[model samples]
Target: MKMNRTLFLITLLSTFAMQGQDSLVSNIQEVTQVADTVKKVPQRYKVEGVAAVVGDYVVLDSDIDKGYLEFQQQGVSTEDITRCQLLGKLMEDKLYLHQAVQDSIVVGDAEINPEVDQLMQYLTAEIGSEEKLLAFYRKNTLPELRSELFEARKSLKLAGRMQAKVVENVEITPEEVREFFFAIPEDERPVFSAEVAVAQIVVEPEITKEAKQTAIDRLNEMRQDILENGVSFATKAGLYSEDGSKTRGGLIEGVKRNSQYVKEFKDQAFSLLEGEISEPFETQFGFHILKVDKIRGQEVDVRHILVYPEVPQSSIDAAREKIETVRKAIVDSTITFKNAAIQYSEEEDTRNNGGQLVNPVTYDTWFDLTKMDPELSAKVYNLKPGEVSKIFVERDRTGKASFKIYTVTDRKEEHPAEYVTDYERIKELALKEKQIRAIEDWQNKQIKETYVNVNEDYQECEFSSDWVKTSN
Candidate 1:
């Protein structure tokens, strides 16, 4: 099926926010017609009228029309969603973007262009070809479509950042959490899925000193080739880098100090001068040689080539034997599983916590079977509480191999939400409520100070924020 135009744009432009289309050319003429013989000008000047102006940004009628189309495209029943709701949302987006620009929140092209390239590539394949994609959007050239997409994406990022800023420091206290939980009536409480707490002990294959030196030597050779022979770093990275970013010449843009990268990787990246490449350094993943492309304030653009040392068959066999010994010790009651994990497991995040695998989404011990890792869920399906699974080989997306054994530490059947048992989840909900209130309060105040003008048609529509008034 041909993709919905607005839905495609929304998917390409934003993470969660849906934005309006900015098509400059349309054939439809809604106004009074002159002589039939007189050629009518295209709708860009007259028919595609402005719906509202928020601060410096204008929301067009086309934007509202596309917004409604986007909702329908997503299979949402828009029967209850009014034109007023759509207009209000677009205005709110504009307000946030305006404030973000005023506040000097930076989102550079280095961050946006990569997304544009990816989206264009995806749209071209889905819509059949580049020409068809452009024709579908009524654009004359690729740059024109890209420019509109960039602006839309930038606006989405700005609004998101501004909203995040409002609630960045908002927190809920235990008292607030209790109050929020109690405020809900008994019957309105949420039901939780059956949950199981999973734990694991992992042992990765040990690379020999010879293998380690080989990888380091290989990186050194590549660095020298690039510096002396003047080979392109990107070309080398595309050819030899094992990291996922290899496709883009190992480019990882918009890296902040607090980005989720390993400490060693961040330290190596930040220590380099612009356009300078580093010697091989080791992170948890592998050895890497990094190049700093550009630094904008606290953010840096970087590219790196990752190379993992060759693990000999002997090393793999030895790791398997070592893990087998640990499992045998637990099975024979010579060592407890938690003690074994603390002493022998090599996965640092779980080793210190008795190998307890916290769910990344919930930040808790519980894993819902439906959403749990398929391999893990399958292995633990028949395991009783406290029984350990047979040792299994695991390979990550990068093909880094490891051996692991799992244990189901606890289990609970599906149940309605309970206060004591689901305190963390409840706390999250309360904090979210507090954050939403904080954002709404900020928006309310900002709307009073900002320029807002709605068209006469929407003048009578009630809005969540005071949108009809202009600031004194």
Candidate 2:
């Protein structure tokens, strides 16, 4: 259940990289316009000055302003301390980018297109519609926005790759973890929260072959209506598509060939020509029919109508009955709970780990009681360690209802963190600190060796690293 911190860092880098020059300038302009309205000042401004030069890369004052504005928008106070920290992080990012280019790291469209599509989808949703988003950014279409953001995305992936290379071999031993735990001052020690470790045996409600055929038949009917009844595909999609984009006429625009869509969906989309409607196709989500509106090079604009098959009440009852039998076997000591989970559980991710539930944030088996699912927390509130709860139905993130049996393996009351009991948690903390130190050391060496020129304006600002040395 350990989280890959390196992957987390890479994702963070990609997000930062998505904030291209135009987007940053737009943000700054919005803020400036708001101020102008309040103070009755002119909205026009002179050119922004350079803040720093890292090797061959130049950091603009607008870049710093963009970072500052992002923090402010996030409700972070733009006081001196926070501002200095933000500036330091930005400088370090530039250093990574410059070094990545020097080291010949190549980031291709395959690595960037998916992230671009995701970001565009999020922004479009945030602004209520793609039309509104385009108007807000003064862009005529979504493709224009993607083009503007492409270089920044590429630079971000390069920086992420460089960071991965730096920390790929770092590891921590048990002794190191113990030493790191004891070294913390008593007052600085972390207070532990009440936590529980639970294991589950899950069985998904099965959709019968007949149910799948029913869904396929329904989709085929819709397809025939579109082709023969002179019904518009978008109109049919609006009336029947089960996806969130049904409100938008089931349209998805500016989708690249390499975007992270389902393989079936992408394959069908890329294979079709403009004004073509595909036959009903089955994907994990449901039965879907693709209508290609337009295709340009590797990108396409398309619409789809999805119809998910329904799981009958009998299927749910049968799954619940199956788990009840497994529970009985475990209770009668015929088989151990862990072995039962290994042999009979339908949940793939947790089955091999003895059906243990992991906290996504901490990536550990122990979950904070307050953060658990309301239904799950309520059920285990009174149960003692090693107690099993009765069979229950719960819907997963995707709304796929499943029957489950849960066993509370371990529980602990809130207390101060201890080396003996919290070794794994402490090890994770120590490893993170080590990784940060390693990155910092690398950044310091790069700053000393590379040519860094800071404007006098920023030279007085407090920096975490000595980027403006006398030699430089």
Candidate 3:
């Protein structure tokens, strides 16, 4: 009941660190006076100055300040948030983490270490250097910062897993979705944004045979050195691999047989023995050499190096001209856009579907205008349904050039939610509401069973969960 209201407020407004010395003094004095009046302030708070403790985890007052600082940095308003609400969120997080530990939810080093590396990389780039990042965070060394980040990330991962487990089996039927939609007041129904169904034809640059051979030769040399010279595979991967996983020595852990790896990559990974490296193999992304580390039941841990051939400018020009030819045919009515896409588009995933782009976030055919990529929005904005855009060169994350032409298949103007037309969105909302209820029920039950203690200053704060008043 109160959970939704409290969470909504929390989302809109979270606490900010005390801005002025006067404000900080006021907070300390208020809590201090509360402590003096009660005459029952916990000794741990006096010593460690923790705000609250839930199960095995302690929420420090400084942690709440840091939370506020993060919210402030993200430009969230903290004007009216109370320390009590901040502490409540920390307590909820701790509760989830504590229960995750009790329930034996495991987060491995392989998962956490990469995240730490990525965070460090991002912060270093943002702060200008690793030394500046260390100084900004007041950390003396990289390992210290990494250790702290590791614990934080592990706790976050555990909390997320625990929350997900709470509603893992929640399901909503069509009847439930229908009922949920009509139950909303007519005027209170959400306004659906303008959305468009878009399709595109992509022509990828064909790699020259010489360039492809060069990439394969490089991998073969690296693999040979790794085997014959007793050189570290990780070292070669870190030095030469073009993939993002290079920072972690190209390590990918807990990969399953059903993982979303390309078929060639997965087949090579599954066929290798521990400590055995594979020969150079080709995938759509490019050539790779992988070494299996260990096998645990259905999961395998492996390290790989990826290398993509350099695309010649001639190939780029050829791709552009090819797409241009296709676009001309479509515009002149020689061939339909869908037929051209099916026959000529090189983007394999969408080619079979007539190059219709699915919204990755919603897994739907429609993309909301406001949230669509700016470049894509600009291209499709003026085009009415059935109009195709001029050929545009696009680059992949690796900066490989391609040419694409887009067609706007359908468009919807902003309107109040209609049950018939917005059934999928309605179903998503219904499922989310059900999951929230399930989480609330879980919290209510867990609070009674878990060890919880709040400072006297926060005992009076109204919490959505029964954090302050759990009884035997």
Candidate 2 lDDT tens digits, 374-428? 5678877777887778888886423579888888889999888888777776787
Task: Estimate every model's Cα lDDT from 0 to 1.
Answer: 0.76, 0.72, 0.77
TM-score for all predictions? 0.65, 0.61, 0.78
Of 2 and 3, the candidate ranking higher by lDDT:
3
Q: After superposition, how far is residue 49 of candidate 1 from its true place, in Å?
A: 9.2
Lowest lDDT 10-residue stretch of candidate 3: 16-25
115, model 3: CA deviation in Å? 6.9
Candidate 2: 10-residue stretch with minimal lDDT: 21-30
Which of the two, 1 or 2, has more TM-score?
1
RMSD of candidates 1 onward, in order: 10.5, 8.7, 9.4
Write candidate 1's Cα lDDT for 309-415 as tens digits: 89899999999999999999998989988999999999999999999988765567888886566567899877889898999998864577899999989998788
Which candidate leads the pack in lDDT? Answer: 3
- Model 3 TM-score, all chains together: 0.78
For each candidate, how many residue pairs have backbone atoms clashing (under 3 Å)?
0, 0, 0
Considering only N, C-alpha and C atoms within 3 Å, which residue pairs clash in candidate 1?
none
